[model samples]
Target: MLLLLPVLPTPEFWITLGNYVGLYSIVAIGLVLLTGVGGMTSFGQAAFVGLGAYSTAYLTTQFGLSPWFCLLVGLVITMASAYV
Candidate 1:
């Protein structure tokens, strides 16, 4: 079932699928917090998510860094961007 899906799809497909799911889940959680809890609708959450993805891609590709390390840097970058 769930375990068989990765075998059926190409590695690239799974990687892309995983990225989209992760991005969407983060956005959804942000939206829930912003709109449901704060009672506000703002597009800034999407920008922060994009900032994170951009930093992750840039760091990983440009510097050939570890994906895990790049992702952590991206998270910090995103938080700092939002704070600024």
Candidate 2:
């Protein structure tokens, strides 16, 4: 299956699809770890992702911050929230 991927005519589409699939896989693995290993049952992951997204959006839109700065601020806020 992996070897046949190069045969696709639209490599860009495949790349985009792989990117999304990889991202979802990471989220899924995190959820699995939280539920299976940590014995936690919650949808906190989605909330955290939302918090980061909103923080970045607000910082960039309201303050006209650079993308890198927004990313840093978002990560800081997310980490702080997780700590609390």
Most TM-score-accurate candidate: 1
Cα error of candidate 2 at position 68, Å: 2.1
The 0-to-1 C-alpha lDDT of every candidate, in the order given, reads 0.89, 0.86
CA deviation > 4 Å runs, candidate 1: 1-16
Residue 41 of model 1: what lDDT? 83
Q: What is the Cα root-mean-square deviation between model 1 and the actual structure?
A: 2.9
What residue runs in model 2 are displaced by over 4 Å at the alpha carbon? 1-26, 36-39
Q: Give the per-residue lDDT of model 2 (tens digit) for 1-84.
A: 788777856578778898779868977898989999999998888998789879998999998989679978998999999999
lDDT of 1 by residue, 1-84 (tens): 878876785688778888889878978888999999999989877788888999999999999999989999999999998788
TM-score, candidate 1, is: 0.72
- lDDT minimum window of 10 residues, candidate 2: 2-11
lDDT: which candidate is best?
1
